[model samples]
Target chain A: MAAAFTAIGGKWKLTLLYWLAHGESHFAGLRRRGAPITPKVLAEQLRELEADGLVERVVTGPVPARVIYRLTPYGATVLPVVEGVRVWGEAHLQRTDGQSVSDTAMSCASSIV
Target chain B: MAAAFTAIGGKWKLTLLYWLAHGESHFAGLRRRGAPITPKVLAEQLRELEADGLVERVVTGPVPARVIYRLTPYGATVLPVVEGVRVWGEAHLQRTDGQSVSDTAMSCASSIV
Candidate 1:
């Protein structure tokens, strides 16, 4: 359990996975979707996810390279857990603050199985 | 999402919650169930959980005193997420290491809704 947490426990990693699972695969797409994560931090977290075998990085083209990240099969297995977090967070926000879960948050929660 | 992770992201917090959800509510029971977490660390994590409104601490009896920890209604919402983690971890262990998820691990995953 601890090992699993260490692999995907970053503040932005799960959110990144949430976006990727919804078809945001390219680097720029992920960065734009993950707005609060600065470019440097996003790069670092992606590197960590790649190292942990949860994400695969692909490079294409000649002069200007395009990099894309996709979940490994192993990584896809984490979607349920991410959904769990999203569900819990939505309930938590509603319970504690009397506010509806945000559209982005709801989308992330509803995107996976 | 980031705030949610910060509240429950400790290595032992979710595992501790798993035990509590299964009815091991006393401090000593939690300690025994959470074998990998040292007493000091358990105390620290429990403190954090209490502060986050996920746990409630109760003291009963006159002589010797008994302290029990249980999930708040708010805290109970997180059980599904923990279940999700347990499922993912079991599948992850099997896929990567060709081994079953430990008994303790499965119980943690199974105890909650």
Candidate 2:
């Protein structure tokens, strides 16, 4: 469980996964979708995800390479988990009027997941 | 999502919740189940969970009060999510022969969830 968490437990990784799961596979697309994460942090997180086999990065073209990221089959397994969290967050927001679990990272969880 | 993660993201929190979800509600029971976590750390994580409304702490008896912990209704919502992660971890263990995602915390995720 903690391994699952360690593999996908960051503030931005799940948000990034949420977007990629929705077909936003390009690096630029992920950056735009993952607004709060600076490029450096995003890059680092992606690297970690790739290492964990949850994400794959592909580069295309001879020049001005177009980098793309997609969830591996293994990575896609997390979709249901993320969806569950999103649903729970929506209900929590409604019940609490968005007052509890005040971490800023949760704001992203609420928005993206 | 991050808030949900932050609320329950630690190495010990979900593991503790997993035991409580299974009816191991007393402090001693949790400590025995959560062997790797020192008593001090377990206390801290439970306190955080209680503060987040995920776990309720109850006191019973007159002197040498017997304290108990159980998931709030809100916390119970996370059970399916934890179950999902557990399934994933089991498959992951089978696939990798238990070599990857080797953090000690993951050991707990694997056992408890």
Candidate 3:
């Protein structure tokens, strides 16, 4: 369980993977998705994901290279867990609607997932 | 997604819930389970879980005050996500056997889960 968390445990890693699942994206594109993750942290998370073999970083072009990230085959294996969390999060939001939700919860609820 | 993470996203919260699922335990009993979590942290995690309504804390005695923790019916709803992470962790360990795994991964893999 720790291994799974180690790979995707960061607050934004799974969210990053979820975005990648929809389609590949450059770092800038990901940053624009609005999770409030700093560039340093985002780079770090993506690097760790790559090292864990769950995400691949592709650099294209000689000048002004575009670095794209996507899930690896091994990384794809974790989609079920990510999807599970997403589904549960959606349910939880409805379940607790009108209840006070923290900024972290609100940000992660609609945008992060 | 963030809501779910906010509820049970602590390093040891889900594991604590998993242990509680098997049976209720006091703070000391949980500390003995061997996760290396400090008393302060364990207490805080349980408190958060309690506040989230996923865990129920019962005071069983007055003089000694045995505090027992267990999963509420709502707490049980998260078992599937926890189980999914566990299964993925187990598979990840097998998939990467003989490969380098960090201390965090090893600790969370066998003992924490």
- The candidate maximizing lDDT is 3
lDDT of 3 at A95: 77
Candidate 3 docking band: acceptable
Clashes of 1: 0
TM-scores of the candidates, chain A only? 0.81, 0.76, 0.80
Give the candidate number with the greatest DockQ.
Answer: 3
lDDT per residue for candidate 3 within A58-97, as digits (tens), equals 9886645477898898888888887777677666666767
Name the regions of candidate 1 deviating beyond 4 angstroms.
A1-12, A24-48, A61-66, A98-110, B1-12, B24-48, B61-66, B98-113
- Candidate 1 residue A81 Cα shift, in angstroms, is 3.3
lDDT of 2 by residue, B1-94 (tens): 3443456555566566666777637777676542566888788989988887889998876645388888998788877776665666556655
Write down the lDDT of every candidate, Cα atoms only: 0.68, 0.65, 0.70
Which one wins by lDDT: 1 or 2?
1
Q: For each candidate, what's the DockQ? A: 0.22, 0.31, 0.38
CA error at residue B21 for candidate 1, angstroms: 1.8
Between candidates 1 and 3, the lDDT winner: 3
Model 3 stretches astray by more than 4 angstroms: A1-5, A62-65, A98-113, B1-5, B36-41, B62-65, B98-113
TM-score of every candidate relative to the true structure: 0.66, 0.65, 0.75
lDDT by residue for model 1 (A24-86), tens: 377777765535668888899889888878898987655343777888887887887877786
Candidate 3 Cα deviation (angstroms), residue A32: 2.5
